[model samples]
Target chain A: MSDEVKDPKDVLICRCEEVTLREIEQAIDEGFDTVNDVKRITRAGMGLCQGRSCSKVIARIIAQRTGKNIEELLQNSYRYPVRPEKFKIFDEEESHE
Target chain B: MGMSTAYYLTLQGKRVLILEAGIFGAGASGACDDMILFQSKKPGINLELAFESLELYHALNVDLKHDLGFENYGGMVLIKDQKELEIMEEFVQQQRMYGLDVVMLDEKEMRKRQPHISSRFIASTYSPMDAQIDPFHVMYGFFHVAKNLGLEYRKKTPVVGIEKQGNGDFRITTQSGEVFEATQVVNAAGTWAGEIAAMVGENVPITPKRGQIIITEKIPMVGETNLWSAEYLVSKLRPEVKTEISEEHKALGLGFAFTRSFGGNYLIGSTREYAGFDTRTTMEGVNAIVKQAVSYIPLLKDIHFIRAIAGLRPSTPDGKMILGEHPDVPGFYTASGHEGDGISLAPITGKLLSDMMCGAPSDSRLEELSPVRFAVVKGEQVQ
Candidate 1:
């Protein structure tokens, strides 16, 4: 009844670049406290899916442990540019007055 | 210059190019309440401009002959308190000064005019001239007309890079590694105009303001008079009171407003979040919007929410437009950052931008809407 839940070593959340539970725990041990900070250290959120896969688990873990409101905590991060432009086209016609 | 600038430019002779970062009207111009009403703007010039624009919309509806879906279904703005009623009354005086005919109606009058509204409202201001339009139809109207008139447009291209050449023309670079040499460029990139300006060493403080909306399924009396809270519109203009939502006013909230668009799609908006380029709707935001909107029109309680989306309005440090030619740049002109009013004033902007770029005389009203003011401030800031 008094046992701590051990994080599954093989459980992986961020599949794009292959981040595992052990790695997340290691970053947590290294004082990367917030979801943003953990993502920065481990690149957990900067994958093809852009944190969508790992954010919820990481947010829940942080919220439960940190005693923060999960709903409010989830709203903390800012999403930007929405689209990463791989290409753009412009012309001198548009550049001129 | 006359509207002939756009006409003649397309007519004659030069390669008339329109720089669209996306599909025509895909930007903030397409994303607005599309209220052509002067219900909430300051009296005097602002209301006059909105009313005149409303009239222009009406005229265009007749001239364009049903293509634009120009609507004149009359708008009703509900007021929950006399404080709001006072503002409408004051604005009426100013609208009268601008030759606008507005009616200051009481609760009974308002209820008679728009019975769908909840009786809790103290009063409502109905501008007989207020109207709506299908934004897509109107924008497509412009694009279709422009296209048929032989104006060339490039899509999915951003004017990211620019070089001022010795010939006093511009060499603009697209993200696609394509460069085009054009003698004139119009910075109508909507919310992204500031970033576009930066490519040309021009600084435009075009801040992107995210306005989100929730559409409710067609439910009768959910509201009428294009119902909106006067407090929301007022708070939007006054900085000190902008976000100040008292505990009592939580039902209304800050910057909270709504407008029932045509087509049975209620355009309930908006929360002005400064979330740059994040168009995704958050549950918190949607919930807040629904809560506030329902509070104003309790009838909305029964209405089911269909969907939620967001549009970024290009808001300047000052709330007005940054139009006209670049003050220092020899050949660059801009018509951007009308913020939430972009849709309301697009025709005027397009007309004025064409006039200014052709190096001809412009309407005096154009001066009030010039980007040169932003340019001058940019000049001072950069120095």
Candidate 2:
């Protein structure tokens, strides 16, 4: 009757760029006062889809670590070329074929 | 003067229907590792052309650089095993062949660049030219830009059928029973290209490879760059390598990878399963991914997992994209099967497709990506 993930190992927060709870705590211990610093060191939420999936959990980890509200320190990182179309999909031309 | 190509036709300021069965990025584009990767191409995979596409992306910074969430976030790959080392070597050579500015660093250099890596990880290949992007946001940007440019979009509208008109134009029927006529058509439907193409009496070989991934709660900044176990890339090539055991599927352990997304979250994945439309996650798969990830970054043992999700890569027979119009059909065109390059390759596709529709020539060499190579042409129709 519990919705919580059973195995502590499988209890993932971010889906796109895999990061873990223990690692978040460790980041906090290392004096990472903010979410961006944690991200800079851990490389979480840096994958294809970016952090749309993992940012909140990361904020929670930062909050728990710094005893600071997540909203105060949570930062957003944006990168470009959002879609990596399949190779052949990108260069479709009618001329060569 | 008028542009006859589909993209041009729509932009030439007319009604254009972009049929989506679901929301934006819900298809193959939604289900990708989304690496704006230009360094991982094979020796014969047209690395030069891929770089050119990256350059096109660079030029789009005016629009793409906006909170479209674009960043300089460089790319880095970790070397954990011999098999991966081989692939990295090949990748380095391919990049170097085109006078690319990528460099392979030794263990010390890698550690210098990525201090978050476990002491065990010895080397890395860092390419500043590679960057990351968010898929959904970029698509939204493209949709808005296209719409502003006068393109009509039909969301939640799936094109169930297409009929060849006696004239050069074609009839496209939507699942909603809405029928439309156009002189030109483009199939950018991602994984459904095979079935979508069948509507026009053509064949597009597309395989839907599902990549399952899991993220953890925010981990400390472990690495400034993306850390990938070359082993997974090698395993993608040679699936017989020995990896940890998994209970769900035999391939889970070997199919694992770790990458830092642009949002400061860790992405652990991914098992490449052939399960059609089955996007569910499994314990065995998650275990395998965690095990492999910890081997390089021992700190993950303390972190918690967030969730598991899958993205479908529009894999093609040739590991290349199928672009341009049909060789045989006058109006039907294709822009699908980008295995994992959908996010990285979109800007390039938009411009090229636009140029093709305008009957204007592209500065980039695309002889290798012509869509007609995959299909046989029949008779021509008058426009």
Q: Could you tell me every candidate's TM-score relative to the true structure?
A: 0.72, 0.72
lDDT of 2 by residue, B184-208 (tens): 7788877788888877778788887
For residues B1-383, what per-residue lDDT tens digits would candidate 1 score against the true structure?
A: 11212434554444576656765456775456767766666654455556556656666666544356556666666667656666667766776677666677788888776666666788866766666776755654454455567767665676678888999888988888888998887776778878777767787778887877766544454434565667776554453543447644443234555566554556677777777787676756666676676566665665556556678888888677787777778778766777777657766655556656666676786676666665545445542
| lDDT values, one for every candidate | 0.63, 0.64
- What does the lDDT read for residue A2 in candidate 2? 75
